[model samples]
Target: MPGQLTLQGKVSAGVESGCLVMESGGKQYLLVGGDPAVVKPGAEVEVRGVLKPDLASFCQQGEPLEVSSAKGR
Candidate 1:
């Protein structure tokens, strides 16, 4: 888990269809490839993931994050 990052933020609904996003360090990151139950808008979450910039995303809003796991904070 050395490269894994733990990010804490409030989930927000992305402008695009079916996208979930979170803001941390003044930057927006698109959350993907995780449990739908955890990746939700308006939920405070501590997300553990890696920056998957190459990950194909429908949202096209923020940098894509390949979620390893996520839980409510």
Candidate 2:
């Protein structure tokens, strides 16, 4: 049920390839293999993915919405 929710946040850190750090609602989350367009630090994003059981991983297999452009929506 957690993955069914859409989370809005800003990219805080673009770490190594396929790994990114984001801050959502005051909480920090690590998203892997995320779209680079939305992984840029300070970039706003709408993530639609499932949170792993570890609670440290956010898997984004679907498309992500980058705040850089309103067209992505």
Candidate 3:
């Protein structure tokens, strides 16, 4: 089974209407179909989910893992 990964970062872009982008450790990740109430750009958050090997590929391929949860870290 895939293990859960937790990352703390700031929301870079995207929105609650659909997908969102988060930046952590100088890297950015696309948070697809996420809740807007849970996060926003410049807000610090802890995201829990399985990490994908190809970050860029996720958008074109399968839907990324659903965000298990998001909280202010």
Give the TM-score of each candidate: 0.89, 0.54, 0.61
Pairs that collide, model 1: none
> Model 3 off-target regions past 4 Å?
14-18, 52-65
Clashing pairs in 3: none
Please give the ranking of all candidate structures by lDDT, highest first, separated by commas. Answer: 1, 3, 2
Candidate 2 lDDT over residue span 1-73, tens digit each: 4345456776655444454666667666665445565456677777766555354333333223222221112
lDDT of 3: 0.64
Model 2, position 49, has a per-residue lDDT of 61
The lDDT, on a scale of 0 to 1, for candidate 1 is 0.88
**Best by the TM-score measure:** 1
Q: How does each model score on lDDT? A: 0.88, 0.51, 0.64
Runs of candidate 2 with Cα error greater than 4 angstroms are 14-18, 55-73
Give a tens-digit lDDT track for model 3, residues 1-73: 3687677877665543345677667666776545667776777888887765555542433325457788876
User: Candidate 2 — which pairs collide?
Assistant: none
Tens digits of per-residue lDDT, candidate 1, 4-27, equal 888999999999978999999899
Model 1 — TM-score against the truth? 0.89
Least well predicted 10-residue stretch by lDDT in candidate 2: 64-73
